[model samples]
Target chain A: MTGVRRKSGSVPVSLATVAAAAEVSISTVSRIVNGQTHRASRETIERVRGAIETLGYRPNQLGRALKRGESRVVAMLTANLNNPVMATVASSAEAALRAAGYVMILCDTHDRPELQDEYLKAMRSQAVQGYILVTNVKSPGLAEFVARGEPAVFACRRNPYASGAFVGIDNVGAGADAADYLWSRGCREPAVLFPAQSSSTIEDRLAGFSMRLLELGGRCSKAEAPGLSHLDVGYEAARSLLDRASLPQGVMCLSDQIAYGAHRLFFERGLRVPDDCVMVSIDGSTLSSWLAPWLTSVRVPYHEFGRHIVDLLGEIWRGEASGERILPHAFQSDVSSDFE
Target chain B: MTGVRRKSGSVPVSLATVAAAAEVSISTVSRIVNGQTHRASRETIERVRGAIETLGYRPNQLGRALKRGESRVVAMLTANLNNPVMATVASSAEAALRAAGYVMILCDTHDRPELQDEYLKAMRSQAVQGYILVTNVKSPGLAEFVARGEPAVFACRRNPYASGAFVGIDNVGAGADAADYLWSRGCREPAVLFPAQSSSTIEDRLAGFSMRLLELGGRCSKAEAPGLSHLDVGYEAARSLLDRASLPQGVMCLSDQIAYGAHRLFFERGLRVPDDCVMVSIDGSTLSSWLAPWLTSVRVPYHEFGRHIVDLLGEIWRGEASGERILPHAFQSDVSSDFE
Candidate 1:
C-alpha cells in the first residue's frame, strides 16, 4: 500500500516495505501498527517488534480516528478552567476518563449561571453521553436535565437548581468544620466570605460556620454582607474588619480564593496571619498552600472529586441511580495555623 | 410538565404549566423560553411570558435528551488545564462551542504522549462528533489521527506526529523577534531562558531564537532548562545566567512564564529590569500586562485561536477542507513598525 509521501520525496516508506523488512504479512504489520493485542502471539509480536525496530513503523492516532467517527472525546464543564483547583481536577479527571476509554471536552463557564444554562442545552446538541458540571450555577434548568436522565455530575459547587447528582465535599459541614477550627483556636468574632447567591453550597457554608459559631456562643455580627468571590471583596472585607476596630479574632472565608485576596490586605496592613487576626479558608489550592507560611485550608479531595464524577457519570450512563455521592472534605492546618 | 421543586416547593412550576396556564401550546412556550424572534405577538408573548414567570418555567435540557437521542457533547483534549493560557483558550472555545449548541468534555492529558494514545480510544467510545487536541504533543500518533478524518481541530500546539489543521503562534519567529529586539537595544549578548523538552512550543521558541540570533551576527545561549513554561524556570535560569561571569546584557525567554521567573530572580539579586538586563518573552498573557511596568512579549491572540478551531471544526463537519487551514506564527515587539 502507498504510504504518506515525504515532501522531499524519494519513494516514501510504506507499510509494505516494513512488512518486507520484517518478513511478516502486511496484516501483521498493520496489527502491530494499530496496537491490536491478543490475535498476534508472542512470536508474531516479537517478529513484528523486530520489524518495527528496523522500519521505524510508528502507528498514528489520525488513522484510528477515521474508523471511529469521533476521536476520543468527552465534554467537561467547569467554572474556570484556569482555577488551579479545577485545573488539578481536570488533570486528574482526564487521566481517569482516559483509563475508562473516554476523551474529555472542557469548557469554562466563568462561573456564570446563565452561561451554564446555555451550555447545558449546547451540550445536548453535541450528543455527549456524559458530562461534568463544575460551577456554582444555581440554574433550575440543570436540575431539570438531571431529572430527565442526563448523565451529569457536579463538582466544586453543587447545583441549587438540582439538575443532577452532586460529587463534591460536604461544603456545609466543611465550612462548619472550618468555623469550629477557627473558633477553637482562640477565635471569637468572625466572618464567612463568599458570593451572594452562588448555590446551596455557599449557603451551606455560611450556615454551617455561622450557625456552628452561634451554637458555640460567639456573638456573630456579619461585618460584610456576602459579595462576589472577587479579590476586591475579600480585600475590602478584611480591611473593614480591621477598620471596625471591633476586628474579630478570626474570619472564615468561603474559599481559598477569597482568603488569597484577604491575605494580601492583611499582609499590607502589617497584620500577621494567625497573630493579629486569624484567617481560615476552604480549598487547598496552590495559592493558599504557598502563602508565606501557608494558610490553613480544608483539603476537599479535589482530585477525587474528578474520579468520583467520572464514576458517577459512568454509572448514570449505565442507568444506575448514583444518587448523591458526596466526597469527603477534610481540614488541614499548618505553620500558618498559629496566630500570634 | 413537572418543574424543578424550588426550595419553597410551590408545586414545582414548569413551561408545560405555563402553557397550561396561558392556554397555549408547548411550542409557544418554547418560543418564549428560547427568546426567538419568531414572534408570538407582544400580547401573546407577554401572556406566555407572564405564565412562565408565575410558573417559574426553566428549560430542562435532560427532558429533550431522550427525544433527540443526542447529548450534543463535544470532547476536548487539553495539555494543561492549569495553565492560564490553556484556560483562556478553553473559555473561548467553550463559549463558541456552546453558542453553536455544543458542550465540551475536557480532558487534560498532562502533556503525556502516552496518555494521548489512551485518550484517542476514549474519544471513539464516546461517539464524540469531533475532538480538539490542545497539546504540544510532537509524537507520531498525532499524524495517525489526522490521517483518519477524525473531525479534529488543534486548539494550540503542533505535534510532529500529526500534520493537519493547527492553530498557534509562530513560537520560533516570536523567539527570533525577541532576540532581534534585544540586539537592537544595544545588547551585544543575549541569552534565552527556556523550558525543557517537555513541550514542543518551548523547543520551537528556543530553536527560533537561537538560530535567528546566530544568523544575526551575535552569540546566544540558554539561561536554564529546568521546569516547564513558568517563572520558576526563569528564576533558576536567571541564577545560572548570573552565575556566568560574563553575563549577557539582555535576556530573552520562550514565554512570559519564564520571563516572570527570571524577573524575580534578578529583582532578588538587586538588578533592575531593562536597566541591567532587558527581558523579553513570548505569549503576551494578561500577567505580562499587569505585572510591573511592562514585560515585552509576543502575544498570541488566545481567543482567536479558540475561534479559529471552532470555525475549522464547523467546516470539517460540513465536509470542507479544514485540514489545510493553518494560522501563521505571530511575533509582537516594541519596535514593530506599528509600535508608537
Candidate 2:
C-alpha cells in the first residue's frame, strides 16, 4: 500500500504500516491503538507495540472516537486559564490524558456562572467522556450531570453542591501553615488578602490563616477584592490597606497573582518584603520565586493534582469508590525574614 | 409546548418554546438558529427573532454540527499553555470566538513536533471549522491541511512549510525597539537570550535586534537555549552569563518566561537590575508589571491578535483574500533605569 506523501517528500506514519508490519488486520491495530489491549492476545499486542515503536505510529484520536458512544475526549474547565497555577495543572492534566489515549479540551469559564453552564452543555453534547473542573461552584447543570452518574472531578476548587471526586491540595492546612510560619518570624499584625467572592478554597484558607493567627496572640485583618485576576485586585487591596495608618506586619494572599500585586504596591511605596511586611501566598507558580523579594508560598502539588484526577477517573471507570482525594501542599519561604 | 425542567425545578429555555411562541415550524426555528436566515422570509425571520428574544433560545451547536460538515468549533493549538502570554492570547481569542458563536478548543501541543502533529490530526478529524496555532514550525501534516483549502491561521509563531494567514505582533520591530530603548538608556554591551529553535518569529526578532544593536555601534552577544519553556532555560543561561565575569550591561530575552528566570538568578546573585544589568523581554504579561523590579517588555497586542484571528478566519470562510495580519507592539520600561 502506498503511504500518503507530503509536498515536502516525507511519508507520515500510518496505522496501515503498523498493521502490515505486525501481520495483523487494520481493525486489530485500531483496537490496540484505542486502548483495547485486553481483546487482543498478548502476542498480538506485543507485535503491534513493536510495529508501533518502529513506525512511530501516532493514532488519530478522532477516528476511534467516531466508532462508539465514547469520544475518548475529556475536557478540563477552569475559571480562568490566565492563572499560571491553573495553566500548570492543565499542562499536567493534558499530558496525562494524552498518554492514556484521550484528548483534553481546555475551556476557560472566565469565572462566569452562565459561561460554566454554556460550556458544560456544549461539551456534554460534543460527547466528552469526562470533565475536570478547576473552579466549579453550583454550576447550573452540574447536579443533573452528577445525577446521571457521569464521570467528573473537581481540581483545586470544589463545588458545595456536587458530591464528586476532588483532587487538590489542602488549602486550609496551607493557610494555617502560612500563619505559623509568619508568626514564628514575629509577625503579629497579620492580614489576609483574598477575593471578595466567597469560594470554599479561599474561605478555608482565610479561616485557617485568620483563626491560627488570632489564636496565637496575633491580630489578623481582612482585605477583600472582587475579580478573578488577582493582580489588579491585590494591588487595589494593598493600596487601601497601605492608606490605613496601621499597616499589617504580615500579609497572606490567596494566590500568587494577588501577592505579585501587593509586591508592586509595597515596592512603589518604599517598602521591602519581609523588611516592612512579610508576604505569603498560595500557588507556588514560577513567578512566585522569580521576583526581587521572592514570595513565601504554599506549593500546590499541581503535577500530582493532575495525575490524581486522571487516576481517580480511572478508579471511577473501574467501578471503584470515588469521593474525595486530597493532595498535600508544602510551605516554601523566600521572604528575607525566613532566611534571617 | 412544555419546557424541559431541570433538577433545580427551573425550566431551561428551549428552541421548542421559540417555535411555539412564533407559531412557526420547528424546522424554520432550526434553520434560523443555525444562521441559515437567507432561506426564510422577512416576516418569518422577524417572528423567530422576536420569539428567540422572548424565550431566550440558546441553540444546541452539537446537533447543528452533526447536520452539516461545518462545525461551530475552532481550535487553538499551542506549544504550552503554562506560558502566561499564551494564556492571555487564548483567553481573548476564546472570548472573541464565543462572541461570534464559535466554541474554542485549546489543545496544548507541549512543543513536541509529534504532539503538534497529533493534536492537528485529532482536532481536524473532530471536524473543527478552523485552527489557530500559537507555535508551529514545519509540522508533518500542516502543509497538507493548508493545501486542502482549510481555514488555518498562525498566531505568535509562523511556519515556512505552511502558507496560511498569520496573526501576531511585529516581533522584528519589537526587537529593534528593545535594542533602541536599551541603547538610549546607556547600554553598550547587550546580550540576547532566546530559544534555540529555528522558528521564523524567534529568528526575526534575533535578526532585527542584533542588526539594530550593531548599527547603533553597540556590541550584542547571543545565548540560545533549546526547549519549549523559556524559564528554566533563561535561568541556566543567566547563570552561565553571570559566571563569565564580563557580563552584558543589558539582557534582552525573547519571552517573559525567560526574563522571569533571569530575574531569579540576578536577584539570588545580588545583582541589581538596571544598576548592574538591565533586563528586557517580549510578551508583556501580568508578572512583568506586578513584580517588585518589574520586567521591561514589548507588549504584544494580545486582544487585537485574538480578534484579528477570528476576523481573518471569517474573511477566509467568506472567500476573501487572506495572508497576514500584523498587530502593533509597545515597549514597556520597568527596568528602573528607564524611570531614572
DockQ, each predicted model? 0.16, 0.27
Q: Judged by lDDT, which candidate is best? A: 2
* RMSD of each predicted structure: 10.1, 6.5
- Which 10-residue window of candidate 1 chain A scores lowest in summed lDDT? A5-14
Candidate that scores best on DockQ: 2
lDDT of 2 at A106: 75
Off by over 4 Å in 2: A1-67, A139-150, A333-340, B1-63, B146-149, B292-294, B333-340
TM-score of 2: 0.82
What is the C-alpha lDDT profile of model 1 across A43-93, one tens digit per residue? 888887887776545443233333443333456777766456777787777
Lowest lDDT 10-mer window, candidate 1 chain B? B4-13
lDDT of 1: 0.67
* Model 2 agreement with the true structure over A148-267: per-residue lDDT tens digits: 666788888886675668887777888889999899888887887887777788888888888888789888777877776788779888887777757778888988888887787887
Error of 2 at A94 (Å): 1.4
